[model samples]
Every structure is written in structure tokens, then in C-alpha cells.
Target: MRRFFLFAGLLALLSGVVNAQDEFVTDSVLLHEVATYAPYKKYQAGAKMESIPASQVEIAQSAGLDQLLSRFAPIYLKSNAGGLSSIRIRGTAADHTSVNFGGININSLTLGQTDFSSVPVYLFDSFDLQYGSSSAVNGSGSIGGAAYLGLNGNWTDGARVKATASEGSFGEQLYGAKVFLGNGKFESVTRLYYFMLKNDFPFTRTSDGKEFDQENAMIENMGLIQELNYRFSSKEWWKTAVWIEHDWHQVQALMSSHPNVPSETLDNKHIRIWSEYENRRHALQYKGGLGFVHDMQVYDNNGEQKIGTDRLIAEIEAKQDVHSSFGYKIGAKYKYIKPDVYAYSSDVIDHEQSAAFYLSSFYTPLKTLKLTVNLRQELVTNFDVPFTPSLGAEYRLLITDLSVLKLTGNLAKSYRIPTFNDRFWPELGNPDLKPEKGMSYELGLQYQYCSAAIQTDVKLNGFYMDVEDWIEWRPGSIGWEPENRSRVISQGVELQSNTDVFLRKMSFNFRLNYSFNPTEIKEDQITSLVGKQLIYVPKHVATVYLIAKHGLWSAFADASFTGERLADHSGSAKFPNGTVLDSYFLMNCGLSRDLKIKEQDFKLSLAVNNLLDNDYQNQPDYAMWGRSFRFTLSTDLNFNKNK
Candidate 1:
């Protein structure tokens, strides 16, 4: 608390310090910085692309939320339960992809769900979606890929303000705002957002031959973010940021197939705080931070009508990095995390703390060629730690100023440690369990041109995970225990295409993503999940988007397809092998225009979601909301736009 107040005072004092100095002010930075020459755009369309300093990006996506989500059949996919669930990257399991905001890592407690609505889409300056294998510098939790979100800093002169409001079908409303303040010596950025939806979905089937009223759910989110950067010296900088988010959700929805599952209600809240500092040496950069999070949840279960759970966790990390003369950049990092969980009935105190150290190096011997290598190790008191290694390379051929060719590949070892709830919950303690480890490989290629560009990237990754003393729970067995799972192998391939056509002021963009996986269980008698396709994992999935932009008018249309998936791990008849839901495609369209009022910039947009009025569900057997429309208006005020 003392440190917090001290930092606050410094920020207050530094606000005036910047005014005393004179400097050329840049525009307010976005939260994340997209990359130019992005690998994924090789074969997709309707992608918002940008370029940042290459060294600044370890692994990330270079697209914005609006551009990425607009390409989907549905305008948006909601993950309201925990973390950010329902995340599918090239048809891989949600767990396969790793997501990070700023520098904080988030893990979900619930399965098959995530909280996407809470992410401040507009505040992010750039996003990097690294597909294939895992990044070693960020640790060993990823097998599919990693998505890194970047927040912007205050650099604009005077103040910059932006506000947006939108209304759509089903009582949907949205509001968002951003403010940037800066002087020569001090800078600050703040953001606010609110979204609400009262969806009235129409389902195709009902047990009583009557369509259900649709899942009625409402989400209220409040976020406060303040970042202050102070120049301790010309080469040294001190920074502190506070972020708080509160969500209130109420749901009275019907479960698919299990209509008798009863209407359910839940209330969940999350609070997080983080602070960091960075300094630059003659040739090295040093950075570190501390973060804390608290989660409180209450829900009604089938047997236990009233149940609640609370969790608190703290994490810390520090790193020192350097970029060398021959385009070689290297870094080392250390991290520690500890979490505590409490339930309504009894307080089960479980702690999972890890100390990790990693060394990573990237070298570009030639201007068009790059190579990267990484090695990492984790130390855990109660579990055996493993070493992870990764390698990647990128080659670019400059055909002409207007065209380019690129090639990329990667190989890595990754692992996932069971969460506290996964290993120590009252009804699910599995002491003999071992962490699952994976090895992955990927290769891709790209081609580009001036007027039109098309790129195709394919990744084939094979992974064999061994869970010695694997843990599982049976309904009538001797509670929860551990058993050796012998062997598990999961393999898949993901292919993507993105292309853009530009002629004078008109442009067209298209994108396609496809993925398939075949997972095999080699252990007999481990009936729980043996011979079963991983639950919630679709064997085939794809999305196509078409968009055009001309002058002040821009429009987009998209369609997404998801194939069959097993509802449970049991290979039994509960949900059969091809008991798949019919594949459905949805289309949506939107238009936007900008206007100048006095000295302010204003913009308006209207979108008609589910243009085809397709009745579809994202999850198997689940009831999805139907056709809807939305309209949005926004304004931007830059006091120094002319400067």
C-alpha cells in the first residue's frame, strides 16, 4: 500500500514535469501494435494489418478485434463463464491457444468457456496471434499458439478523447471511451467501456415441441485503467498502472438436450492489480512486474442450489534482454505464482507456486533470414519439473518492391500443469498425477503483391503426451484417484489463406481457416476418455470472410462452419460418434462512414447480424440466439490533430 501511494504521488508530480519540457508529441498509442508482413495473412482476407518494430514482438497477432471478429459468421462469440472460453484457433482446442494481456497470464477454472466480453477491444493498440507450437519465453503452457495483447502509452500532446455508442437488436447496447494525456516527461492513458445484450434466441427443437424463450442473459462490465510513465532519467523510466474490472452477470437459460437441467443463475466477480518498471542499459533492457487477482463466484447447482467459491492469486516476473549487432536478440525471465481457493463448505488450502527461468535467442544473419532458439525450465516443490526447448526460423524473398515471398517453421516442447482446482478440489484430489508434456512442429509459406496479395500457410503438428499416474473421477468409484494413463497422442494440421485486392480506392479481402485432428488413447481399461474424440474439439471447422472498403464506406460479410464434436469423454451412447449437429452457416453485413463536425471527427456505422437469419448454435446441442441488427456511432477529439 505504501508503494502504491508513493507511485501515485510521483505520477501526480510528474504530470507537471512534462509541461516544462518541449518535445514533438506523437499520437496516442494503441494498446497493441500489429506487425507488418504478418505470417497469417498469407491466405486470409478482411484482415486489419499494421507494422511495429519487429524486435518488440516476441510472438503475437497483428490484428484488431473488429477486423478479426467481423470475419466470423456471428458478429461475436461470448465466453461469459471463466477466463476466455470458447476460444478456437484454426479448430484447435481452446486450451491449445495461450492468451495474455499486457504481461498477465490468465487460466480458466471452468471448462469449455471463457469471458471475451470483458477484454477492452478498442484500448488495445495491437495484437499478435502466433500460430503453431508454443513460445518459450512466455513459458510452456501453449501447444496450439499464443495471442498477445498490447496496451498503448500516452504520447499525444494535450489530451485525446474518443467515445462510441451502439444499439442493436435484442436490446443490445454498447458504450466505450478512451483518454490520453501526456507532456514531455509524463504520460497517462485511461479507458472505459460498457456492453449489454438481451438476446431472444429461436431454437430449432424443443422437448415439448415448443421453442424455448431463449437464454436470457445480461452482462454488466466496468473497467478502470490508469497508466503513468515517468522518466527517472533520459535512459531510465518508471511506470505504474492500475486496472480494475467488475462484471455482474445474470443468466436464466435452458440447457440443450437436458431441458430438465433447470434454469441456472450465477454471479461472478474478478479484480486484478498490476505494476511494473523498465530501464534501458547501453545495450540491454530490464523489466519486471507484480500482479494480484481475486475471483468470487456464486451459482446454483443441480443438487446444491446455493454454492460459492472464492480464489486469490499473486504472480511476479522479471526479465533482462538485449539485441545484438547481427540481429540477434536474447532474453531471460523468472516468474512465480501462488493461488489460494476457498469453498462454502470447507476451506481447502492448496498452493501451486513455480519458479521458472528461460533463455531465448533470435538471430538474423541475413536481412531476409531469421532464426530463434529458446530453452526453459520450471521448479516446483511438489511436482517434477521439465525442461522445454523451441526453435523457429523465417525467410523472406524480396521479389520486387511490390511483391515478397516468405517461409516459416517451428518446433517446440510444451506442457500444462493441472490447476489448483483440477488437482486438489475436495471431490477431485489426484495426488499421483503427472504433468502432461507435448512436442509440436509447424511449417508455413506466403506470397504477396502490390495490387493483390494471396498467401497460404499450413502447419502440421504431432504431439505425444504421457500422464504417469493420470487422475480421473468416477461416479461410483472410490472417489477421485490417480492412475497411470500409459500414453496419449494428439495430432492435427491447420491451414489458412488471406488475400486482399486493391484498385484505386476500392479493395476486397477474403480469408479461410481449416483444421483437423485425430487423437488416440493407447491405454486400455481407462474407459473414461479412451477412444473418444476430445470433448468440445471439432474435427473440422472453417470460417470465410469477404469485405470491401471504398473511401468513407466499408462493408463486410462472413460465414463460419464447425463440424461434429463429442459432448463427453465417454465413448458410450450418451452422445454418439457422428451424432453431430447439422453444419450451419451465418452471414452478417455492416457499413460505416465518417463525418467532420466543427473541429471534431465523428463516425457512424450500422450492422445487420445474421443477415440470412440462420438458426445455429456454436456449441453442440446448445441453443443459439437468432438474427439481430446493430447500429453504432462514435467521435474522436484530438486537441492537437493539427500539430
Candidate 2:
């Protein structure tokens, strides 16, 4: 009854606003206005960069980052019963892929991986995925690829407010609010969000094949972000942003037999402050920024284990457009990381520092040919960092008024440093471990066609990567210790296509993506592991989606499929070949309605996830949730009457 009253009040307010307006606004007109004035721009280089569109972002804002990426992108996510999730790209480990926020690396230095489950999709205005080796554009540890998230500072000439509320299965609830205010020269933006979930869904145990209800699984999270921008002059501006977040989760057991005892709990806190200045008045444009991050994690079992990390980052870059067909960029970056662990007997306070310099040049010799070269050098405190270099080329094969064909290729060398836990852990740390090194090569072709009625794009790419001195933990004489003891080879092919057709009063969009990645342990100290596939790395994955929009209504359906994968390494005797997980398919659908009143826009959306209720597991023994449903209500209002 309360919800009904609230909705009724909102409808009354909207009706009043509609009566005050001079003309009725259609959804198509609003969409066109947004597209014409939006500040976000997609990357257009020859590299295989994919940007998430604003429409898709808006639809996925209620979901977490992991769910959005796993369903829409070609990446793979290994989730443990929807509680803890990690990402993999191009058949590489989680640590090999970097996640950056506003040009700062956000991965944990102690764990060497980012937990995708805890990240929110609404925190950033734009998301970009760069495939293959990107250590040249991004920093180190990008052997597989990189993901970039950024907030656009450019604001329109008015003030706007947006709020969203959602409720879903498993006792899920979410609320978010954002405010944008600008007056041409100065702008301010703030966002706040809160989420909670019981996570007590039922699942079947893979070992015994018995259904049981999950317990002791609850999550609560909240975050706040504030950004300020000041345009000192027509050609220069300054921007600053601060973010704070907290998360608490209750841990659950992997199997029914080994139920959680003493009730484990985990808590995480993160704070970041970043600021930058840019000047583009002269022929040479330059930008610089400074950032600081503080992260803390605590786990409570019988006792408490706490870890804290502090990072300081500084970077500067300059770009010069020497001519119409050529340009160059030079940059330098420095990072210092300090970590403290309270659970270790030994003094677990340590610091690591690194500095890197890079230079990139782009040349166009002919109307249809372009080439790029990049070089980077790094110096670390106690480790030997390698000198990385890469070369990329693109050529237009054919060009016409309505169609174009292009070929692209890239080759690069990259490396990853060992984590602090790998080198400084009590009694098991290895101080002499070498950094993992790898080389990657890729080639692709893209074809695009556009006409009055339809537009289509298709791309096909293949990549191969070879790594030496791969790091792994093994049973030593004393205890388990980290070592560089294996060689790996990963090769894959990716195919993607997108089509959009415009009709009289409706539009149809379709997308298809598929990846075939096979990673193998070619050489290992243990003879049994050689010539075996890497554990948890699937060989085949595919996704498809179709969407239709007509007037004020829109609908979409999508599906994803993941192939079989080994549960454990071949050398392990605890699990045999039968422990492999079978392939599974997941389907989802959504329907949404849009409404406009004066300068305000309202949307109501209903989404059904896991529509088939397939019982499956991304990780062995960790079952996933069944079918689930969610409903969301969101509104955007412009408060400035001058518009």
C-alpha cells in the first residue's frame, strides 16, 4: 500500500509538470537530444577496443559489474555461487588483466586481483575493453587485456537529478541517487548508492546431487562519490573527484557437509582521491594528475585477520600533433605501494616502488595505410622489470560510399611482477622469484556497412601468447611456497557481429559474439601436468542478444553458453577426469517503458534472469542461483527552468 501511494504521488507530480509544458515530448526526440549533446566519445583507433553504449549501461545499472560484463561482453567470469567472482580475458589468469579507474590501477597489491562482485556498474560514466596486449597504452600486467572506467567531466548547461529504486529475488534491494549541477564554467556532480541482499537462495550440491538452502550468506554495500570541475580559462580546466565505499559480506560454506562454523565475516573499505589538469591551448597539449588510494580488508573467523594497503600515484603526459598525418605522445608515471598485515607473526610492513616511461608515435604514409609504434621502460625497487615494445598497423583494403574493409595487426611483449604475498609471506614467501614474461601477437579484419535502412559491423581476430616462468604455488620441503616453474601457451579466435535495422516506428538490434580459447601447460616440472589443459579455462564461449524498441516500449532477450572445463590440474590426484564441469546455457529477458513529463523522464523496467532455472556451476562444487526476477523504477528530472 505504501509503494502504491508513493507511485501515485509521483504520477500526480509528473502530470502537473506535463500540464506546465508547452508541447508534448516524445521518447525519440529526447533520445536524439541526448545523443547530440552527450560528452562521452568512443575510441576510434585501429586497436580492438569495445565501448559499452549508454543505452546498455542504463539498462544494466541495477545489476553489479560482474553480471553486466558476463552477460553482454565476451569476457569470462568465474563465480563462486554468486558470492565471489573473478574475471579472465584471452585465456589468462585474473592478475594478467588490469582494471583501471580514471588512469589509476585499482587491483589489490596483496591479492593481485580485483573482485568483480563488489564493483558497481553505476560508478563510472564510461567503460572500455581493450583486447590483446595493451601494456603500451595501459601500464604493466596487461598481457591479456585491460578494462578502463572513467567519469566524464564535461557537463551540460543545466542542473539535473536522477534517482533509482529496485527490488529483486533473494531479498535484494538497491537505491541510488545522482545530482549534476553546472553553470558553463564550473560544475559539480555527486552520486550515492546503497545495496543489500540476503543471498539465501536454494541450490543443489554437485557432489551428492541433493538440494539444500544456502545459509550465512548476506551482503551490504554503500558508496558515495563527489566530483568538481573548474574551467579556469577557455582552453584549460581542472577536475577533482573523491570516492568512498564500504562492503560487508557473510561467508558461506562450499558444500553442505562442511557448513560454516563460527560464522565467518568479511569487511572491506576503499577511499580514493584523484585530481587532474589539462591545457590544450598550444600546439602541444599536456595533462597531469595525482591520486591516492587507501584500501583495507578484515576477516573474522575464530580470530581476526586485517590487511591494509596505501598507494600513491603521479603521472604526466604530453601530446603533439606535428602534422595532419602524424602525431606523438610521451608520458611518465610513478607509483608507491605500502602494505601492512596484522595477522602475521613477523613484522609485515613493506613498501614497493616503481617508475615507468613510455613513448608512442603514429604515422600515416598513404591515404589508406597507418602505423603505430610504442616503447616503455620500467625500473623497480627489488625486481628486474623488462623493456616492453609493440608495433601495430592498419590498412584499408577497400572503401566505398556505403561499405569499408580494413585489416589490423599487433605484436607486443609484456610482464607481471609477483604480488607482495608471494614474496613477503611468513615462512612461505619466495624472495628470489622472477617476474613472469610473455609475448602476444594478434591479427584481425573488420568490415562495416551502412545504408538508410540498416547498418552492420563484423570483426574476426586471432591471438597467440607464450609465457615463460609462470608463477605457481607448490609443496616445498617445509610448506607450500611460490615458484616460477611452468611454461604456458594460449591461443584463441574471437568473432563478433552487430546489426541494426530502422523501421517506420521501431528499430531492431542484434549482436553475436563467440570465442574459442585453449590454454595449455606445455612444460612443467611435474611430468603428469605437461600437455594438459589449464584448469578452469573453458575452450568455447558464445553470447547472443536481440533488442526491439517501439515508441515508449522496449524489449530485449539474451543468452550465453560456456563449454566444459577441468576442475583441477592434471597432476592433482584428489579429483579425476570426471570432475570436469559440463557446459550450460543461460537466458535472460527484459521489458521497459519510458515516460516523459515536461523536462523529466521516468522509466519502469522488469528483468528476468536465468529464465530456464538451469542448475549449473562456473566453479566445481559451487552451485549458482536459479531463476530470478527484478523490477526497477527510475526517474531523471532537470531542475533548471531556463532551459
Candidate 3:
């Protein structure tokens, strides 16, 4: 109720922001808008990037980032029962991957990572992924990769309202609504979502065939977002957005500890506000954002813990137009982190601040070749962070109206800062720990074929990285403490293929993805740990999916496979150095039909996840859900500008 009242108040306040505005995105030959705060324009000349189309975005609006990425691409997620999920790209640590909203790094300052489960897809208009060490572009915490989520300005002259409701197995429910109004100059978008789940599905222990019900796993979450865009004129515009969400969840005890299960619950709340201004004529842009998060945890022993974090960020950049065959961009950014944790040593609030200046240049000496150089230097109030630099080149061997082939390569430096827990924990924290720094290199080949009826695109890439001064908790004089323990060398191969076929009355789309990642500890204090794969990082992953659409009916089937993974860092005393987990396969399929009733549009879909009822464990002792069904219905109503 409080959230609703706040939403109403903010809505009423933004009601007066109607006026004229201009477009936000511009077109370029090779690299488009790669602004830190802008939408995903991943058609970068020498970068390995991926984008989920608007169709998929619309279908998964109520889902989480984990769901959207996992369903559409071949990515790996470390998931546990009771609504906990995190992502890894190219075998990087969970914290090494960064997720950004409106150009702000949303990773937790205390834990150094974002909980993908808490991020909803309903808040953004775009989903983009950049793989393999984008720290030079996205600052620290992007050693592995970066994800950008943004909302775009709307200039269409129409007002539309969309609503969706869903019910699924194991007591799941979801309701969401989106209201959008736009004129030639002003646009307003409002979204509201509520979801609840009682994850009580029964699962059988693979080893003993013992049956168990997933108990004490319940989740309730709700949120609202309002976006307002106004073009001051053809060359200047301003936009702002506000979001608020609250969630409550229970973490079910693993089956192994059933008899001794403890009652544990967590409550979380998040609030974010973002605003930006841009002038295409001057080639200048400004962005600012503020976000707050609070979490409370309660255990069975009557002990409770609370944590709060606030993030404030600002950025300004200018781009110089082409002079000769070269163009460049320069920007500066600042970020502040305020953390309040009951677990900290002091009762006073602690804060961290960092600022960075970055420069990037684009040069095209020939019609078929493009080159880019990026450099960044960050200054921290505490530790001395190193400078990051990147070089990229793309060469087109063949370019024509019908087909094209290009080669891309990049070399970059990446870094990661010590998290709050790593530096300020009650007693075990280490403030003198060195920052994690790394270097990465990648090469790729891309081919595209297009025709009136058929289109195909294929890309293959390989990457290698070495990270030094890896931070981890180790046994010290008394207990475990954070330290720069070892070095890691990660290497991987990735392949992606997409094909679309348009028929007289039907269209078909197919996509295939495969990745082989092997991350090994190169230099560790413990001899036995050397050459061992990181825990929970898979060596192989593959996915394939197809979408077929007719006049009013559509269907999709997607499947993914994970290879065997290591479950422990230390090998058992007897044989192999570590405990290995079995690989598993999963499949999901859905069908939907569109209907036109009077003036409104309606859609109904049925999806079956884990279609094979396969048994799998993302973590030791934690079992995943089996086959389940979900039914969703959505309605869309549109009114003309005259209305």
C-alpha cells in the first residue's frame, strides 16, 4: 500500500511533464551510440555483442533478467531453489560480471555483485550483453562482461495500455500493466507489476530416489516504474524515470539438512531514479542516477541482520565529429557508495568514492576497415587502481548488398575493486588488499547473408584472459580473511548462428549457440589447487531454439545443455582433486495465439519448463524444480492521438 501511494504521488507529479522532444539514437556506419548510459547499440565494429529483439522483450516483460537471458541466449546461471540466481560469462566470477541500469552499475557495494533474481524485465526497453572484459568501457567490475538495460524515448502519436496475468504450477501468480502515451514531442510510460510464488514442487533425490517437497520457499515481489521523456527541441531533450520495488522471500533448507532445517527469511526494498539530457547538435550528453537498497534477514535463533546501500552517479561526455578519417569521444564520470551494515565494525555510516576519465577514438582509413582505441584512468580515495586501455580493429574482406564477411579483434585491460565486505568487515576485513587486475585478448570472424526470403548470420569468437591478485578469503592468524591469493587464466570459444525464413503465410526463426570455457588457477599458494577448474564453472554449454509464427499463432521451443562442473575447490583426500557434478539438459516450449476483439488485442500463451523432468543441481545439496506449466493471458488497447 505504501508503494502504491508513492507511485500515485509520483505519477501525479510527472503529469505536467508533457511537451515536445526529439529522438535519442543516431545512426552510424560502424559503431553507433556506445554511451555508458544509452540503449544497447552493440553493432560495434570490433566487439562481441548480443541483443535480444523487441519481440522477445515483450514476451518476457514480467520475467527476471535471469529468465530473459537464459531463454534467449546460451548463458550460464548459478541458481538455487527459493529464488536465488546469479550469472557468469566466460567462466568469470559472479562479481566480475556487471549489470547496469541507466548507465549506473547496479552491483552491490557490500557483496560486490547484483542478484539477477531481483531484477525484473518490465523496467527496461532493451537488453544487451557485451562479453569478455569490457572494463575499459564500463569501469571496474566488468572483468568478465557487462549488461546494459535502458528505456528509450517514444515519439509515436498513440496511447496504449497493456496488461498481463499468469498462473503456473507450484502456486505461482503474476499481474502486470503498462500504460504508454506519446506525441510528436512528449512521451510517458508507466509500468506496474506484482508476482508471488509458493515453490513447493516435489523433487526426488537422484542418488537415493528419496522424495522431498521443497518447503519454506515462498516469494512475493511488487514494483512500479514511471518514465517521462520530453524533447526541448529538435536538438535538445530531457528524460527521467523512477522505480520502486519491495520483495520478501524465504530460503528453503537443502534436502540434505531437512531434519535440521532452520527458519530463514529476507526482506528487500529498492528505489531508483534516473535522468538524462542530450543535444544532438552539440554532440553532448549528461546523465545522472540515484538508487537505494535495504535488506533485512532473520534467522531461527532470533538473530537479525540489516544492510543498506546507496548509489549516486553522474556522467558527462562529448563526441567530436569526423575530421579527416578519425572521430573521438571524451567523458568523465563520478560515483559514490554509502553502506550501512550491522555487520560492520563501526556503527557510523561508511562511504566510498571513485572518479574516472575515459577517451575513445574511431578511425576508418579505408572503406572496409575500422579501428578503435579506448583508455580510462580511475582514482579511488583508498587504493591505487591501475589504468585500463583497449584496442580494437575490424576488417571487412567482402562487403556487398547480398553478403558480408568481417574479422574483429580486441585487447583490453580490466580491473576490480575490493568490495565493502572485503575491506570493512568487523575484524577479518583487509583494507590493504591489492586490487584485481587482468588483461584479455579476443578474435572473431563474422559472416552474413541476406535475401528477400532468407537471411543468415554466423559468428565465431575465441578469447583468453589472465587476472592477477585475485581476492579471496583464506585462513589467517585467527580466522578467514580477505587476501590476494592467486592468479587465474581463463580461455573460451563461442559460436552463434541465427537464421530467419519468411514464407507466404508463415515465418520461421532459428538460433543456435555454443560455448566452451575452461578457467584454471595458474598460481596458488597451495600446490594441489593449481591447474584446477574454478568451483561451479562449467566447461561446456550449448543452446538451440526455434520460433515459428503464422497469421495469428506462434510457437517456440528452446533447449540448453550444461557440461559437468566442479563442485568444490579442494579435492577429496582419495582421488580426483575436486568433487564433480553431473551435467543436465533442459527444454522449454510455449504456444500463443493472438485475437482481436472489437478494438482491443488479446494474447494467450502456455509454456512448459523443464519439459523432460530432468534432475539437476546448480549447487551442492540444492535440487532444482522439475517439469512445470505456466499459462498467461495479456490484453492490449490502443487509442489514437485524437482520443
RMSD of each: 11.3, 8.5, 8.9
Question: Ten consecutive residues with minimal summed lDDT in candidate 2?
Answer: 15-24
Point out the worst 10-residue segment of candidate 3 by lDDT.
16-25
Give candidate 1 regions above 4 Å deviation. Answer: 1-84, 88-93, 109-114, 117-123, 231-236, 255-263, 300-340, 344-350, 366-368, 396-401, 451-488, 522-532, 569-579, 641-643
TM-score per prediction, in order, is 0.78, 0.91, 0.90
Ranking by TM-score: 2, 3, 1
lDDT of 1 by residue, 509-558 (tens): 55454456555555646555466654455665555555677887777665
lDDT of 2 at 65: 75
lDDT of each: 0.51, 0.77, 0.76
> Arrange candidates by lDDT, highest first: which order?
2, 3, 1
The 10-residue segment with the lowest total lDDT in model 1: 16-25
Backbone clashes counted, model 3: 5
Q: Candidate 3 has what TM-score?
A: 0.90
Local lDDT at 624 for model 1? 61
Question: Which is better, 1 or 3, measured by TM-score?
Answer: 3
Model 2 regions lying over 4 Å from their true place: 1-46, 258-262, 301-304, 343-349, 570-578, 640-643
